[model samples]
Target: MKRTLISALVAGCVGLASFAAAAGTVVVNGSTTVLPAMQKISETFMAKHKDIQVSLSGGGSGHGIKSLMDKTTDVAMASRDMKPAEVENVKKNGGEAVRFTVAVDAIVPIVHPNNKVKDLSMQQIRDIYAGRITNWKDVGGADARITVVSRDSSSGTFETWEELVMKGERVQQRALLQASNGAVLQTVAKNPNAIGYVGLGYITKDIKGLTISGKAASAETALSREWPLARDLYLFTNGQPKGDTKTLIDYALSPEGQVSVKEVGFVPVPAKK
Candidate 1:
């Protein structure tokens, strides 16, 4: 009888150890634009879910989606939706990409705080990016050569800019291409003649956000769809997120997670009325 009890206790301990080992870590990779909010959400989540670990990294949205297709990441943070080709590629790789819209953001044109240009029409902004308006003076700024700063092609921010501002045209080769939104912000803030576009969250006192058609990029404007460059921020998962991946996503969509969205300077996804 004692032997039977001892054996049962040993099996119970083994089962408990196996359960603990089954708790896996979640890895998130992707868009720099979504990094800030994800970082905050992860922190809050970790505080509550001490058993699970969450890791995050930024490489542009394209890279993030690719990582998901490759099965390297549990989640992909994107500032834009997956492209058609990307959707097919994930399917071919034995995975389906599922997107969850977590927040709303606007791509705001930024310049050095010292820049005098305050407002630009959509056409003028388009002309500047296309390298047609090469001088700040042409756009009502000081007489200095316009230095165009742009996000790298892999960036979702760049994709949104192409769709909204460039239309079918290409950004001129003369433009300086930065890899991430933060890089664009830093470049624009440092160069008085430089102009770049970044997610609205990145706008700081060091850089001045340009008024598009006399409308500033703000949470109210973005949520109301009054900001011309407004777009949805996404979290992509392979297949329909299950296990820890689902838990993390659920936390991000929770009321507390939406609060983190607002605290991070981005607009939260609105609750159903």
Candidate 2:
């Protein structure tokens, strides 16, 4: 009975294995950062192709890659590129992991709207997350202790943050870890002293997006790779997609689908001239 509802958008937190593919169904699983835009795109895709069903879910990027190697999902949405070991694992399964860039994203640091501190230097951000700077006053805000919010390790957003922001240092043990972008957003939005990072698409009025090192996060900066935390969003398949899989990927990269990407606050892949 639950499977009959496959055409409807399902929660990203649901277990991936719970979904069984039918003849015309396409199972998409992966990064929560990419989930919102894909949800919008899938709705448009399904509307035009009434005979097809698209099931979307999120469990972070690693889970999506694992599902692809396990032959459980048709398409894996990721906010970061596949690591070499992940690619090798697919080869062991007699398949090749192929990536299609669907959009560009900038990981933006966010804080509660009332937080007076506006911009943070890269070194200052590193210090705060590393616990070197524990109070908001240390970086020019109130004297209260700062609460650090972070995405769980399995997330691609975490991996990107670790690479571009943390460098060699680790986030301190005291930091609160959330499972999804939406979780991080809500946690920070409710706490005046909390600071967290999320994909640019997740930025909303509930929280204020902070400029990192004097550069604001925006589509122009992300598309040009001028933003320090900018990265490409991807759709990965077990191999060169065929049949319905190819059709879906094609539509996602089409101009029409790119419009949906922009509408969702992500930077669309530049069209080929």
**Lowest lDDT 10-mer window, candidate 2?**
1-10
Off by over 4 Å in 1: 1-23
- Compared with the true structure, the alpha-carbon lDDT of candidate 1 equals 0.85
lDDT of each: 0.85, 0.88
TM-score of each: 0.91, 0.94
Residue-by-residue lDDT tens digits, candidate 2, 49-165 = 888878888889998988999999999999889999999999998999999999999999999999999999999999999999999998899999999999999999999999999
Best by TM-score: 2
Error of 2 at 121 (Å): 0.5
Cα deviation of 96 in candidate 1 (Å)? 1.5
For the record, the alpha-carbon RMSD of candidate 1 to the native fold, in angstroms, is 11.9
> Candidate 1 clashing pairs?
none
